[model samples]
Target: MSEPTAPQVPAIPTARRQALRQHLMNEVTRPARRPQRMLVLAPAAAVLAVVVAAGVIAQPWAPRSAPLIVPVHQGEHVGAPLLLNQMAVAAADTPPPGEGEYVYIRSRVAVAELGDGPARLGPAYEREIWIPRYERGDGLLRQPFLELPVIGVIPDRTTLPDMPPNAEVVDLPGDPDELLAKLHRERDERGRGSSRDGAAFTAIGDLLRESLLPPPTSATLYRAAARIAGVEVVRGVTDAAGRRGIAVARTEQGRRDEWIFDERTFEYLGERSYLVADTADGPAGTVLATAAVLRRAVVPERGQRP
Candidate 1:
């Protein structure tokens, strides 16, 4: 290789150099060169200053808090907006008069919607129940008790009402058992008819509401789970509803997911099971996930996510 070459400077006119220096000095000291855009940029500067001030005092421009979705089950809105078609759920009814009461389940049912709008919820379906039977009894039974299951449908925007008492009659039917059956049927039908969903729906709604509203007795996660399940739990914490609850979850071995929720309502946090298909305007899909509390009794019939 040839010998290394030393860098050389090109000659510039002294007057040109002085002019450049003067221009730089003027830029620095000439009243800061009053930008040609003082008026154009003033509002933006003011807004930026305001935003910074707000961050210092109120955090107005700080990022918002994350959504919250605590469900009794796992996968917030992954499957579908929270809904059960038909559920054979057990409810308590009169058991032995002197002994403890046994659980009586509704043989059939249709779960209700949680929030407003048709897109978010599903239709009602049939359900059945199961209970244990077959116990030896003392001879000569006077008052035998059995709870028969009933079916119910919920009407839009309705509330449940209490059942009326049985009427006293002097006359007697030829068959007392048949009369009893007729009476029960009438009562069940009437109970269901008066309210948007009948007595059955009312009771189920009540039970769920109780399950959802909460501030657990304690702060332990296990205790919180116990509350939602309705076990006689010891040492749990209350959720927003002020009742103890066990946070229900559904997860396989290893998967990371997030539950998106409305920041204001703090309702359920969930995600759609699949990506929403695109539409003319944009990606088209309903809210796929949600967290709901029955006890909260906040089933929206027709309202926006507040």
Candidate 2:
């Protein structure tokens, strides 16, 4: 019998390939809030500085029992520059996990109705990702639901670049302008005809949501987000988990997409999308998607929840 030829893998456009890799591996920023869903155990001391610095703060003379910061008043807003800077500073202070471990994420998603029907809520799910420290093209991904199989055997950047077997998400530019230019270049490479501001906003959100990058990298992402045009602060928006927080959002194609953060500390909470104008398939005010990230942590192996 004749020998079989190996399958050819398509090549990803250079810029987009870079973006996709960054999107996946750099997904978590901090652990989830609730006790039952908590995956990683962070020392109270580790987060104390961040909690005090980022969140609302009480007067020094105030009783020791005082809360860290005052709750956000209705209609309060934070400018893009301020918000991003704050997040960046906090991210810069966060500690990175040790090597040779897997990043775990637990989340709940709510899918919206398009045509005058009620929205649908999807069950919570978990994702496990193993990023190799020294091995190239050996990244592993396993979803802890529906018996999804392991990935990363393939090394093609085009056909399965999103599932690339390499931990290629590090060393992102820390400069906001440089990062913005990079995203713009990638958008241009992909020939995206939409508003560059919209593209940048979406790219930043995707970056923040998908990857728990190094603090400095995460900070750089927030700063890059501040440069997007049409970005604004929205008050009183709630995440899928019903936690109310302010949002940084952009309107494109008659829909507003938002990244929500805690009202007090400004820690990233979740994200949501809703119609600003009626669409062909849905009315104005129709929501599209809402998600709450419950937890993220490094675990010892696959099939581990925390």
Candidate 3:
């Protein structure tokens, strides 16, 4: 007798396909509860399975969704120069990492999902990075859990290139003016962002976030930021970890980027970005991104923690 043929499943209907796509998109933009433990990174095969199940093509470089509108809270206006000066003092006391050491930073972070739809904030996730002290040294990035449909699945841990993201220069000038000029020149060379001052402010923030700068260099960065035209102080700000503090901020292109500091100690705590006005990406007062630095220390190896 001939063998029986296997059953064939029917194809999904067009209407059902649309509904499924919408539902998956909504789920991707929904806010996620804070995870108690770090989740294991999914392998490439698993990630591919998810994409196939969703019936959507992955575009890692494209925007996933718009930012979600959040409650707006007004802050007290203060002198940016004074707050930045205090931060400079605090930064001056930080010791730089020794040679053959890595600067380890662990943080809780969230960012906006840019895509076709109303604005929404991506879920908060933990991120850890080991930045090498010397140039041409290997680094590492550990992001075990993140709901980033646009960027696709990120490996739990990955080796970094010679110059890691947001930290290109290991050494910098100690003079504020020189640092400011240098930042502007680099920004111009890259042709990034809209305004020169805004780019400089952003570059300073990027450097502050991931690198362990020398005491003088760190101090100079804050002093240099103070010289930016739109720099100001915003009070009553909170980071992703729910730590309340004041912020040194600058508004550019309908967004306000803030560097939060502890209220009592004036120590740098984290950074936040929010929408200043209603736009295509989201409504006014939407939080585009937020991060809180949980730990920073010097480690002898890439995977080791202090």
* Top-lDDT candidate index: 3
lDDT ranking from best candidate downward: 3, 2, 1
> Over the stretch 1-306, how does candidate 3's per-residue lDDT look in tens digits?
995332222356678666655544333321111112211112111111212233233323324454556555554345888778888898788765555467788878765544333445556677787776554466777775333333334467766655332133535667889877876776576574447787677667766665566777778888988888888888888988999998888887778888888888777788887778887656888876788889977777888988
Candidate 2 lDDT (Cα, whole model)? 0.52
Instruction: State how far residue 78 of model 1 sits from its true place (Å).
Output: 23
TM-score of each: 0.17, 0.63, 0.72
lDDT of 1 by residue, 1-306 (tens): 895332222343667545544443332111112222110111111111111111111111112222222222223332121111001111111121121211122111111121121222122122111111112111110111211111111122221112110011111232323333333454464453322212222222222221221222111212212222211211122222233432222221121112222232323322111113332212232222222232112222212111
Best by TM-score, which number? Answer: 3
Comparing 2 with 3 on TM-score, the higher-scoring candidate is: 3
lDDT of each: 0.21, 0.52, 0.63
- Candidate 3: list runs displaced more than 4 Å: 1-78, 94-100, 145-152, 164-168
| Residue-level lDDT for 67 in candidate 3 | 53
lDDT of candidate 1 at residue 134, scale 0 to 100: 18
